[model samples]
Structure formats: structure tokens, C-alpha cells
Target: MERRPAPSRGTAVRATRQGDAVSAALAETDAFTSAQDLHARLRAQGAAVGLTTVYRHLQVLADRGEVDMIRRDDGETVYRRCASDDHHHHLVCRSCGRTVEIAGPEIEAWTAKVANAEGFVDVVHTVEIYGTCTICAARPAT
Candidate 1:
């Protein structure tokens, strides 16, 4: 078993088969996926994992900043494997769910400036841009 150091605040996550299964399933997809959908897929594959476990583990991973999370317009939350460890945003294809991780230095500077001007500290932010990707744009509309 490969061991990693504990995260900040003295919290440790023990490795488990179900957690490994969730990570593996997530890594298999390039698109963001709902936890319920991922749970169903794992059950279909005979992963022997429960929905609650999936949710719990995903929250842990998200809190650790090991995954990217976004909320759809209809309020559905989704998760995807992070492509880069550095601070970045996401460009998502609305029709196809394809996602690209990107960095926006200008946005970062703007946010910092705004926050600091208001005397805010410890500011955190997330930005996700959704639009049709090239392939989706090329397809004929139904």
C-alpha cells in the first residue's frame, strides 16, 4: 500500500476499497458526473459500494481539493477529476459535458483586487464557463 502524508489540520483519510473504486470510476470519465450517476454505474459494475459511501467519499475528496466541482444551472452538483493541481477554472461544453481546465490570471487579479479593496481576507473563488465545444457547435441542431 502506498502511503501519503496526512493533509493539513491533522486529518487523515484511510485507504479503502470503496474509496479506490470511486476514484477509479471518476478517473475513467472526462466529464463531470453526479454522485448518484456514479453510484449507479459502480453498482452496475458490481463494485459493492453504496450511494451514501459514494457521497461521503466524494465530499472528502472535494474538501481535499483533489477534484473539481461545479453546479449546473438547475442546481445539480457534479464532480470531475482535477487535471491540474494549481489554481484554475473550467471550460465546459454545455451540450456534450466535455470539460477543459484553464487558468485565468486576469480574473484572479481582479478578484483579489476587489476583495482587498473591501478589506476581505481569506477569499476563495470558483469560475466555470459553459458553452458549446467545437464538435458540438459543428453538429446539426435537432
Candidate 2:
């Protein structure tokens, strides 16, 4: 099992029941899920969390780096509990919202080289590759 760092002080200090439920839901999945999907799942499980509350909790998690947020090809945002604290990129399935975490030493080197060339310091970046998965690609076109 992977170990996650404890939340810093002043952020997520008190985990409300709703927040706990939301976190539990997120912990159950590795795929990227939208707020609406999470809300529906919680409702199905008899959790008394509203959609707005789910969105709020997800935002808090993202802000604290506990979860990763990425925009889909359709421009909808999705959230997933981060698997690691280390820097990584994601390959996302546009159809099913599945995600694969990847590390690229070459990409990191390139980013640093570009930053230095542009006279930029303290650079940060996000990379998300979106495409159809095998299942989605194999299906007949709609």
C-alpha cells in the first residue's frame, strides 16, 4: 500500500462527514470521475451528499494536491485521487475517462531546457494526452 502524507495545518483540518464520504468515494476508483458521476454514485449508496457539496469537496482536494484535476477533450473537468506525490503526467481515455500515470525523464529534461532558454525560473507544467482506448476505438462509429 502507498502512504499518503498528512494534510497540512489550516487546510482540511477538520474532515466533515460529507467530506469523508466524498473522499471515500474517490478512494474507491482509479479512473477519472466527474462531480456529477460521483454525486450519482454517492446517492446510489445512500450517502446524503449533494452535487454541489461533491464539487466543493473535490475542489478542496485538488487545491490541497490530494487529487488531480484534468480537463477532458470535451472540456469537462474530471477528478481522481492522486496515486503518488511525485511529478508525473497522465494519458487519459477520452471515451471511458480511464487514466494512466506515466513518468518521463526526457520530458522533464526538455521542460527544464526550454525554461532555461526562455530565461524562466521556478517552472511548473501539466501534460495530459487524450485519446480513445482500445475498447472505444474498436467500437463501431456512432
Q: Judging by lDDT against the true structure, name the best candidate.
A: 1
Model 1: runs farther than 4 Å from truth?
1-13
lDDT of 1 by residue, 1-142 (tens): 6543345435666788999999899999899999999999999999999999999778878877788888999899999998899999999999989999889999999999999999999999999999999999999999
Which 10-residue window of candidate 2 scores lowest in summed lDDT?
1-10
Q: Please estimate how well model 1 matches the true structure, expressed as its whole-model Cα lDDT.
A: 0.90
lDDT score, candidate 2: 0.86
TM-score against truth, every candidate = 0.88, 0.85
Residue pairs in clash, model 2 = none
TM-score of candidate 1 relative to the true fold: 0.88
Over 4 Å off in model 2, which ranges?
1-13
lDDT (tens digit, per residue) of candidate 2 on 15-111:
6788889999998988899999999999999999999999988887887888999887678898999788999998888788778898978889999
Candidate that scores best on TM-score: 1
lDDT of every model, 2 decimals: 0.90, 0.86
